[model samples]
Target: MTITRRFPATLLALTLATPWSAWADRVYSDAQLHYVNFVQETDGMDALFRAMDEGNIHDVAIMGLGVAKKWEESAPKAPRYYMGDEAPVYYYSATDALLADAILERPAAQQARLHPFIAGFNPTDMNAVNHIRLMLDMHPGLWKGIGEILTRHDDLTALTKGETARANHPALMKVYELAAAENLPVILHSNITSKRERAPIYLEELVEAVGKNPDTTFIWAHAGTSAEIHRYQERVSGLHDIVSTLLAEHDNLYIDLSWTVLEPYLLDEGEPDEEWVALVKAYPGRFMIGSDLVGRFDSLASTIRSFDAFLNALPEDVADGVARTNMLALLPE
Candidate 1:
């Protein structure tokens, strides 16, 4: 049976307002946190550490944005965001190095808290596998995982100005093979369906990726949901059924409870959803929390604290596992 409760607004507000790191009560390890923005700029190491301190986040699965939103010559004004202009977004390969450099700049203790994952490669490119190998060789011990590998993203797919990346792409297969060989976890973002499609058009592709590579630990980002997807359809009716079925079948698969998956699924109107609480409690080790905050520090505490309501509803041990240990357990020793 699933336990349910509405999180007290006053308690939540107080938790968000206070800094927990100093109290040594830092209870979270963000399973997914972006270190850089679309343009490859970060909140700076100092600011990031400060935010981490404030949020009581002990560790992070940090990575850079895979695609860079370009400023086209035709556009007179500079676009601040990816959606700000009509300029095409392209694969930015240097992102891995930028992330590596930032981590390297920090003190050894601070550096250990940031687990760098490589993004910034085109999943459709055949050479992408080689790039992954190269990053591992170059950094030696820095990389913990591979991805936010973009595949069948909503507007980003059309704006990407190249071949669409499907989860079952041959190039990505090789990448998965490499990750398996390296014993690294992969975080892939492949939308289950397009914005307007009622049926899950792209579900097969993701299933294919997971089924074919049983050795690879794959974290399906947001359980195949996106902000735009929810905007078009309030919810994917079959999401719960689909996820339960997949988890039962695939032991290597994990679901990332990023920002997108929180609403209309995990939490119902700010209270913990009983069904989702049951789903998570059923597979305690497979569900992990993530902020998915990109290049921002101000909201890190609030963003992570958002998971509290849902986490608090689960058994204490299960709640602790999802919030702290699950993602870190996936990383290399």
Candidate 2:
């Protein structure tokens, strides 16, 4: 049976109240987003499409939540979010089916602009690659990419009720092999380091994965940053240097300028960072923008537009690519 929980009232209100036309005057493209939350719930595709049209988002790379936040008995009430309490979250393998069904239910016109990715398996399980293979076989033309795979996510990692996931996990390497064979790009959420770490301690794992999977396209989500990392103000020191070096070394690796990566790295207090600008200019094809919104469509436009300052800082062509075309280019024909 499919399980679901009610979205928090405050979040629902905020999502619905934000005017879609808030950015009607400016259209932006998103490279990473989720149509469902941790509990596998959304406001339906109708609302999402309306938001997309009104928000002027012409294309998007969307996926389902890989982990489902469980409402444990000890947590007096149900948790509305992944971090709502000490409740444990687990891999929801059925999420890929749900995502595929939702997209198949949509009209072809609507589906055209929506690039769906497979993301509902345990990355550490040896059988995880089997699940991915099965999903691909089950829905041959539906899946455009792989992942949003959770790895080394600080709070989520601690709360997750299973083996720890890492980019360099044996199972994930196999999955990468399959992705390369299938010509599907992979989006991975492996943090560069833990919150308190001063250096990019976990960088080697990601580097190893990217290095080994030369043929598999890997889009490092948030450029290896996360909300909790940003919230605690414990972002890895020398992140810019780390990212620059990775881009310089990895030809198959790409970075998404998601909401979490926008501040500090790409922009500081709404001002563009010259270092990041130089990096993007140096490798314009490897960068793209995303809202990182999960199950909330109202803020999609504003969140994507948040990158406007950094995008504006780039040359016109480079800005256009980061704002739109670059992500589309990643979709395999």
Candidate 3:
């Protein structure tokens, strides 16, 4: 029962007529749409699709549980510090099980392009491993990957009494082992350090996980970005060297070049960093771009377009790989 929505004629005509730079042309097309990392709600799928259509993105790896509750009802109960009175916040519970069901229930055409990742939240929860196994058992083919699994997440850890999940915890190791056995990629969001000093305190857990599980492919979400880290800290010095070292050491590791978090490291004074360019060229297949859009669709095009400069700086083949090809390659066969 999949439905394939054809691109609108006007959009198609525009896509063909626009003389985008050679790099831009390589990243998008009618037959080939850029892949995105999606955090979508069940009620908002149509809007997401529309946004994707507008952005010329046909495929998405849906992350999180997909917006379970309304923001007002789910807002933090404590009187937390606030910088702005009107800062936007969303509260939703998206489980991997729910996301898998949503994708499976889509029309056949849509299902073909939507890949769902299983969620394994709360490593301390005794049932976390069993819960993930149950979901995988129930829907054998519905999910293609695992995570945006929260490890050392500041906001989430705050909600859980400051108990940060560790990548190599016994419970998480079980889950990672399962992912490897299933041949599915695992997307992990493990911040490198808890403090704003860019000390790389908690990075060893990630390195250990990758080193231990050579069979499993791990996509380091946001390339170890933390919004809270950025808000308090100055730029992380030698970030590129650290990342390049990780890539060189681990064949199983990949980076999610999502928005805002990676913007600083990728560019230097609004220009592409030559060192970053060389690193990417050396391992062209190791990067993928994601809008990291949650529940909202308006910024879709702008987010994807933001990477144009970064993409333009790379060799055509490597740029294409980062922009779209690598994501497709990671999908379940």
Listed per candidate, the RMSD to the true structure in angstroms reads 8.1, 8.0, 6.5
Cα TM-score per model: 0.92, 0.91, 0.80
Model 1 misplaced regions, further than 4 Å: 1-26
Candidate 2 per-residue lDDT, tens place, 1-333, comes to 121211245753453333323434545668988989988888778888888877678788999999999988777888889989888899998888888888888766677778889999999999999998899788777788998888999999999987899999999999999999999999999998888775778899999999999999999998888877777764657888888899989999999889788887898778998999999999988999988778878887678777888888887667777887678777876
lDDT of 1 by residue, 99-187 (tens): 88878876676777888888978999999999999999888878889998999888889899789999999999999999999999999
Q: What is the lDDT of residue 149 in candidate 2?
A: 88
Model 3 bad stretches (over 4 Å): 1-43, 66-94
Task: List the global CA lDDT of all models.
Answer: 0.87, 0.84, 0.66
Ranking by lDDT: 1, 2, 3
Q: Kindly list the per-residue Cα lDDT of model 3 for residues 67-101, writing each as its tens digit.
A: 12222344555222222122232322345645555
Clashes of 1: 0
Candidate 1 global TM-score: 0.92
- What lDDT score goes with residue 141 in model 2? 72
Show model 2 residue runs off by greater than 4 Å: 1-26
* Model 2 TM-score on a 0 to 1 scale: 0.91
Better of 1 and 3 by lDDT: 1
